[model samples]
Structures are given as structure tokens and as C-alpha cells.
Target: MGVQVWTWILVGITFAIYFGIAIWARAGSTKDFYVAGGGVSPLANGLATAADWMSAASFISMAGIISFSGYDGSVYLMGWTGGYVLLALLLAPYLRKFGKFTVPDFIGDRYYSNTARTVAVICALIVSFTYVAGQMRGVGIVFSQFLQVDITLGVIIGMAVVLVFAFLGGMKGITYTQVAQYCVLIFAFMVPAIFISFQMTGSPIPQIGMGGKVEDGAYLLDKLDQLHTQLGFKAYTSGSKSTWDVFAITLALMVGTAGLPHVIVRFFTVPKVKDARKSAGLALLFIAILYTTAPAIAVFSRTNLIETVSNTAYKNMPQWFRNWENTGLIAWTDKNNDGKIQYVNGAALEGKTPMFLSERGEHGQRVISNSSTGPNELYVDRDIMVLANPEIAKLPDWVIALVAAGGLAAALSTAAGLLLVISTSVSHDLIKKQLRPDISDKAELKIARISIVVAIIVAGIFGIYPPGFVAAVVALAFGLAAASFFPAIILGIFDKRMNKEGAVAGMVVGTVLMLFYMVRFKTGLVGVLDPLPESEWWFGTSPEGFGTVAMLVNVVIAVVISRVTPAPPASVQDIVENIRIPSGAGQASTH
Candidate 1:
């Protein structure tokens, strides 16, 4: 079958399943809408959480990053997975015992102040919206490739589909849909890895295949290292990042992962505090399946890509190369006019353009003098690696279609999860809790729906325009969460004397410092000053790793302020004690 027909059939089937799940699991009460009535089994909730947590970045882009960055990219794998351990041990069970509907709900009640809650809500909105933009962009990429539409139109279609599920079922519908998504995405991710592994290393297991000897009796890693050295790239097994930066980035990612409101809220949907802990454990296992295999897939795809394209004639370039080139992600200008593509490490050579657009001359031949320099000629968007793996390996058309469906599932599930948090924070926390405390559940639910619509529209706009800020916002979201929310939430649970004043100061200071660094160094939002480079950074920290410093600052500031201030009220202390024990902890109440 053709790519188009296969894609439509597979994607159509998945969409039908999602819509069916939405209809069958529709929410009636605000409780159902927010926490699925707190009746979900641990296993089911774990699967749903895995789907909710693994966004398009995890599914489509992670391995490609590992492929290119080599050992440096291991930061993502270690950081993301390590955070789950913290969540399961320190936060999930206690939060489930607190029995609140949202993260801000816990913050507000714990501090006995609406101001603290409002600050938390602001942080949640910032993180969730920033994260959602990436998901929407992933959705657009998948749709543009599969449906043969413009990226803008694809984003619109993705927005509409998300609206249907989020608008109809809220959390109740979203949870079940995510369960289905987990199944589809995992299947899509694994099949190609297994196939490619067997083809290359004679091992059915991808992890072993990555380290196993190939047909030439050489270890895959050894071969990759040799190839990288010959091509002027860093060794595949060695990294160039400083040790402190890696440590800082990994810690930031771990804390940020645990702190993200959308992820923490998943624990609330289960029946008991114990179940919440079990769900986190199970979710980690489900996520690990992909995490461990990603590096293997990276090795396979990187090797294949290099051997296939490097020093090959342009006329002999594979169909996948041309297909991606049409997307403007991959371009070659034949810098030497030899009609051959030279894929090299452009960063190794200063003031050299790797890829450029060649202007046509009178004879319609490529003219190098008129070429325009931008991104490297050999550039490849990391997101395309997973999506194009099956095609590049010449797998069946159905397999390619299945990969497309899986990518969409990953993006949509996480996007819907984020949109839910953004909506609930507004309707439940901001409007109902603070503004209209006496609002009816019916009215609150209406407001929630309206909030979702607005959130989706805004997310779509960010995806369509995709500013430079939007491109790096996922890192920003993680850093912001690490700085602003993680310490407060952690301290609030463990420390009875953590006053509202201290928590608020920590959050505000942490958020402000993190944003200042990102805007000045990363975003260039303030043009008055040039951003500092790595050598000039404080403690040699990159903006990506600055969150660790910000987090530590928040913790120290909070401790100092709390010591000088009066302790929390006795009732608040009692609530903290009650949550820790979890003896009589009940289901999260809608009220």
C-alpha cells in the first residue's frame, strides 16, 4: 500500500479508538472530570500516567538527540527516570493522602493562604503552557508528514482533535484515552528497534544488540567510536560536557520532573495512597521500557544515517533523504561542486557552512556562489529520526504508518494532560477557589470547559508561530518547575514549620532568578546585553543547568526565612502529620 493510504488507515483507527474511549468514559461530576472519581486501579493508572508523562519529546526526539550528542545526551535518560524515584518515594503517597484535586489546592490549604496558592497556580500555568507548545509542535510535525498538509493546517487539526477529547470527558476521558495511547506508542517504538537490531547485530533484543558484535565481529559501540573519530566527531562513548554541568543539568531535570504539576496530579486519580505509590512504581517500569531501548535505537539510526549518506553522490541519495530535504530540515549545496553529499561535523570547522541552498544558474545547474548560509547543509531535525526510522530501514509501509500513529498518540496524550492542568488551575483554583468560592459545581465545570478551549487556542498559536523561545521552552519549563515548585511542595510535605511567607519568598525568588537567567542568556529577550557563554557563566553553569543553583538558593532562602518567622498554625501541622501516616487517608474529595 501507498504511504498515504496506510497512514490514513492506521491513524483513522487510532482516532476512532480514542473517540470511543472518550464517549464511554465521559465525566458527569467535577470529581469524575478532575480525578476520574478516584476509582482507577493502580495498573491502569500506571499505564495512563506513562502515557501522560511521555510527551512527543520522549517518543520522537530523545533518541535522535542521543544519536547526535553521544554520551552527553545520557543526561535526559538519567534525569527523567531518576525523577520518578523521587516522586514515588517523597511525594506521590503523601500527596494522595492530602486528597486534593490539584497541586495548587495542596499549596493553598497547606499554607493557609490564597496568596501561596495563587503563586503556585501562576507557576503551573507557566510550566504547563510552555510544555504544551512543544507537544502541539510535535502534533503538527506528525500530521504534516502523514496527511501531506501544511504545518499550520496540521496544527489546527491536532488542536481540534484534542478539543474533542478534553472538552467531552476531562480527566476521566483523558485517563482512559492515555491508557490506549500507551499501548499504541510502546508498540510503535519497539517494533522498529527489534527489527533494526536483528538486522544489524543478530540479536532480537535492542539493548544487547547495541553492545553486541556486528557481522565484522566488532562491538557496535567500538565501530561507532571509530566512525566518529574518522569523521571529526566526538567519540560515541565519550562526552565533551563538563562534569559539573552534567551533574547540574541531571539534578535539575530530576527535580523538575518530580515537580511538574501535570505529572504529580496523576497520583491523585488513584484509589488510595498506597495505590498511588504502586502506580508510580509501575509507571516507572513502563517508561523504562522505552528509556533503555532509546540509546540502542540511537546507535542503530546514527550508524545507518552516516553510512548511508556520507560521501555519497547526491543523485544516489536515498529516497528518505530527499523526502526529509523537502521539509527544509535537510539540505546540501555540494560545496565542492562534485555532485556528492559530504556529511561532516560542521562545528569542528570554524566559519564554514555545512549546508546551503544553491541558486540555479542559466543552465539550471547548481551555482555555489549564490548559495545562502543558514543551518548546516547536513542538518537533520532530531524529531524526524524516530518517525523516519521505519522508512529509512525499508520496513513495511504499515510499520511506517504505525510509527506515525504512535507519534501522534504520544503528542496528543501529553498535550491533553497539560491542557487539563492549565484549565483546572484557572477554573478550580483561580476562579472557584479564590474569586467565586461559592460557585456551584455546575458553574465551575462550565468554567473549566471554557478554560480548556482558551488554553488549546493559545497553545495552537504558540505552536504555529514557534518562536525561538517556544523551541527551547521545554527546558525552561523544567527549570522553572525545579526552581519554583519542587522545593515548596517537598518542604510543605515534610516540614510543619514551613510558613506561607517562606514558601512564597522561595517561589518568587527562585522563579525570578531562573527567568532572568533564561531571558538574558538563553532567549535574548532583553537585547541591551549580550548573553554570557559557558566559560563566563557563574560556576561554569549553562542556562540549562542553572535550575540546580536556583533550586538550592530557594531552599536556603526558605530555610532562613522560616526560622525567623512564626511556625505554621497547629491545625496545619496536624494536617502535615496526618498526610505522612496515611492511616485514614481517603479518596480525593471533589468538595
Candidate 2:
């Protein structure tokens, strides 16, 4: 069968499995909805956690960014991996011990204030929404390209799929569903990687093949570096970002991962503190399998793309190239009217992607309506690299279909998790806790379902019209999480003297500061004014790294305010003390 037929078959089967799990394991009560009835095995939770953590960003965009940016993209690998370690060691166990299934619930009870809970809920909404946009966009990218539909239509389809399972089973459904997703996504990611690795180098293992020689017996990196210098681009192993920016982005992603409410809540699904710790460790192992392979895949895809397209006749390009071109992910402007594609480094369009013309050019390639000032004539969206890698290497139809299925699994799994967070925050944190403390579990569950549905719609909108692509948008979400929740959660746990006033003030300031910078610089829309130039960056920090500054400011503001204000009540102080007891995260009397 062809790629499209195989795509429908694989995507249909996996999605059917997800829907089946949702029906079979549907949530029975608030406990089931919130934390899978807190009975999940460590291993199961670990797999689910791995699936949840590795969103479309990890499966799709991370390597794509690395393929394009080269060594500069290593920050994502280091920061995200380091951040998981940070979460496992610094945050996850204690949060699990505290026994509030949600971050807002923890803050609300820990700080002894609904106001603080409300703030945390708002922050969670912002971060999760921002993050989910990337996941949904990833789904759209996979669907639009593989299924041959418009990206907008693709996002809508994804929204419906997520709503089915997420609405039916909540976290109970999402957990097991993620385990299946993890298997699909991981296998899909590794198979082609192995194939292309062996095809290029003698080694079948991608990690080893990355360091091995090409057919010419030249080191693979050496060949890639040679190709890069032949073009107008920097060498593949070089870094162009300032050291400060790199440090900031890495810090933001790391702490942001630690503070992400969706990831933290996974720890709550387990039965005991020991189970949480065990799951964290297992999750790291599972995560490393893909994380370690990403750089190799990046290198392979980058090298393949340059060699395949550079100076090649547009008419002679392969079927995969034309397929991607039809999706508008790639284009040719035919600068100087050359019949060959010029894949040299530079912008091929004024904007992020090519605006394609309705008609084809002289070489019968997709004509871009927009043109660039530079010499480069081709426009290839980086997000397409991982998806197109298998096709570029001429892998079988089944492998490409599996990749599409895996992309969906990765995207939908995380989308379900994030939508659940949005629902839990609204129904449990905002409505049940604040608006109607007397609301019944049935009503809250109903509300949570409604919240998930509504959240899915909003996510679809963001996917249809994103501020940026997957990694960039996800990084901003991390920045928001780091700035707002990291200090509040860490301080609330460690600082017995920390009060509600300080926590609330810190969260608000940090979130607002990060938002201001992101709007002014990243998104470029603050009350209709132009985005500030790079020269106006705060102390030369990019928006992605600015979260570290916001997080520090949050810590300082939280500390200074807590010193001047009255200390937390004796009962609250005692809760903090009990959480620190290394023996185990005991039952939360607060819960």
C-alpha cells in the first residue's frame, strides 16, 4: 500500500486503541479523574510519565531544531534532560508527599489561601495553554503533511480525537493511553533512525553511527561540517548564541520542566512516595532512550537534507520533496532564474515560512509569493525535517506511516494531559475550592469534563494560529512555568516562614514580567506596537532566557515580602516541616 493508505491504517488502529482504553478505563469518580485513583504501579506511571513528558516537542521539533541550528540546539537536550533530573530530585518526591494532586491545590493548602490557589491556577492555565498549542500544532503538521489535508483541518481533527478519550476517562484514561503511545512513539522514532544510520554508516545503532564514518570512510561529522562551510552557514559543531542566552534558555527550560504542573501531577497518580521516586527514576531511563538518539537523528536528517536538495535540479527532486512542497512546507523562488535549488543558509522569505503562489514556476516547482533579500532560493520549514527524514532516506511506506502514527500519539498524549490540567484547575481549584466549596464530586466531575472540552477548543485555535512553531512556543511555556510556579512550589515547601502574601506577590510579578518580555519581544504585539529590537533585550537576554531573570526576581520578591510580613501560621509551618521528613511523604493531613 501507499504511504497515505498505510497512514490511515496505522493512525486509525492506534487511535482506535486510545479510544478503547478511554472507554474501558473511564474515570469512576473524582479520584479516578484526578489521579487514576492513586493506585498506579510505579512502572506504569513511569511509562505514562515518559509519554507525557515527551510531547510533540520532543518527538518532532527538538531534533528538527537541532538539525537546523546544529550545536546551538544542544541547550534543549541539556536543559530538558537536566530539568527532568531537577524535577525528580528536587521537586517530584516532595510534591507527591505533600499529597495535593494538583499544584494549585498544594499552593492553596500550603499557603492557606484561596487567593494563592487562584494565582497558581491562572499560571497553570497560561503555561498549559501555551504548551498545548505546540502539541496541537505538531499534530497538525503530521496530519496535514501525511494525510494531505489543510493544517487547519488537521488541527480540528486532532481536537476531536483528544476530546473523545480525554472527555471519557480523564487521567484514568490518559495514563494507560500514554503507555501505548510511548511504545508507538518510541518505536516509530527509532526504526527509521536505525535504518538510515546503517544505510549511511556500517553501524545499525544510530548513536554509534553518528560518530562513525560515511561510505567514503570520512567521519560523518567531518563531512557535515565540510558541507556547512561550503554553504554560507556556520560549521555544524559551532555555536552562535551568546553564552548568557544559552545559559538563560537552559536554566528556563530546566526549572520550567521541574515546575510544569502537568509533569508534577503525574507523581500524584502513584500510591506512595517511594512509588513516586521509583517512577521518576524509571521515567528518566525511558526518556533517555529517545533523548540520546535525538542528536544522531538530527545529524542524519541535516546531512541528508543538504545533500539531497542543494544545487539539485528542482524538476529532478524526489517524490517526498514534491509532497512536502504541496503542503507549502517547502518552496522555490527561482532567484536568478536558476533551474536548480539553492539550499544555502539564509532566509528565503520575509516571514517564518513561505507564502506560496497559486501557480508553479519555470521549473514546475511551487512558486513562493514572498521572496527574500538573500541569495538562498529554497524555503524548508525546520519542523518538516524529522517527518521528512524517512522519506528523504527512501524508507518503506510502513515506516513512514508508523512515524505519522507516532507523531499523533506523542501529540495527542500530551494534549490530553494538558487539557486535563486545565480542567482540573478550573473545576477543582477554581470552582470547587473557591466558587462553591460545597459542590459535590458528581458536579465537579461534570464540570471537569466540560472544562476539558472547552480547553480542547481553545487549544485547537492556538494550533491553527500559533505564536511560533513547536519548540519556540513550548520554551516560552517553560519560561512561564519557571517564573511563576517554581519559586512558589519550592519556597512553599522549603521556607517555613513563607506566607501567602509573599507567594502570591512573587507569582504575579514573575508571571507578568515574563509575559511583558514575551509579548514585547517574542510575539511582537503589545497594544499594537512593534516588537522591541534585540538591542532592547534585558541585559542582553533573549525572551527564552528571560524566564530565569523572572524566576530570580520571583524568588527575591517572595523572600523579601515574607520577611516583612507575618510568618505562616504554626499549622502551615508544621506542614512544611512534615514534608521534609526524609523517611517518606506521609499521608497529607492537609489533603
User: How many residue pairs clash per model?
Assistant: 3, 0
Q: Compute the lDDT for candidate 1.
A: 0.86
- What tens digits encode model 1's per-residue C-alpha lDDT throughout 243-289? 99999888998999999999999999999888998999999999999
Q: In model 1, state the lDDT of residue 397.
A: 84
Q: Estimate each model's TM-score.
A: 0.94, 0.98
Q: Report the lDDT tens digits of candidate 2 across residue range 1-591.
A: 999999999999999999999999999899999999999999999999999999999999999999999999999999999999999998888999999879999999999999999999999999999999999999999999999999999999999999988998899999999999999999999999999999999799999999999999899999999999999899999999999999999999999999999999999999999999999999999999999999999999999999999999987899999899888887888887879998898889987788877888887877777798899998887788889999999999999999999999999999999999999999999999999999999999999999998999999999999988899999999999999999999998889999999999999999999999999989977468778889899889999899999999999999999999999999999899988887545656765
| Candidate that scores best on TM-score | 2
